[model samples]
Target: MTTISKTRIDGMPIGLTLALLLACAVNLAVLARWL
Candidate 1:
């Protein structure tokens, strides 16, 4: 069984970083299309 601890902010940083990366990629794509 896998147990996840919600008390730590460990996973949040990684998840946020990935989300930011994806958002930046999408923004870049849009800018490219507009150019």
Candidate 2:
């Protein structure tokens, strides 16, 4: 459901936004498991 856009900042690809979001989700999952 995510769309990668051609426009970007400082040459970084827009697709990375989803990757960052997923990384946050994984971090939360690990935190939940630890808690």
Candidate 3:
């Protein structure tokens, strides 16, 4: 149980980073289309 929780904690930052990057890419695409 501890190991599983540790792995999940480790994965969270990577997931968050990916989500932020994806959001940034989507925002940039929208801005480009509007401009």
After TM-score superposition, the amount by which residue 16's alpha carbon in candidate 2 deviates from its true location, in angstroms, is: 0.4
TM-scores vs. true structure, each candidate: 0.63, 0.60, 0.64
lDDT per residue for candidate 3 within 1-35, as digits (tens), equals 99996787577888786787799999999999999
The prediction achieving the highest TM-score against the true structure is 3
**Residue 13 Cα positional deviation in candidate 3, in Å, after optimal superposition:** 0.8
Error of 2 at 3 (Å): 22
Q: Which runs of model 2 end up more than 4 angstroms from their true locations?
A: 1-12
Model 3's TM-score against the true structure: 0.64
The model with the greater TM-score, 1 or 3, is 3
- What is the per-residue lDDT of model 1 for residues 1-35, given as tens digits with 9 covering 90 to 100? 13454434345788886787799999999999999
Clashing pairs in 2: none
Once superposed on the true structure, which residue ranges of model 1 sit more than 4 Å away at CA? Answer: 1-12
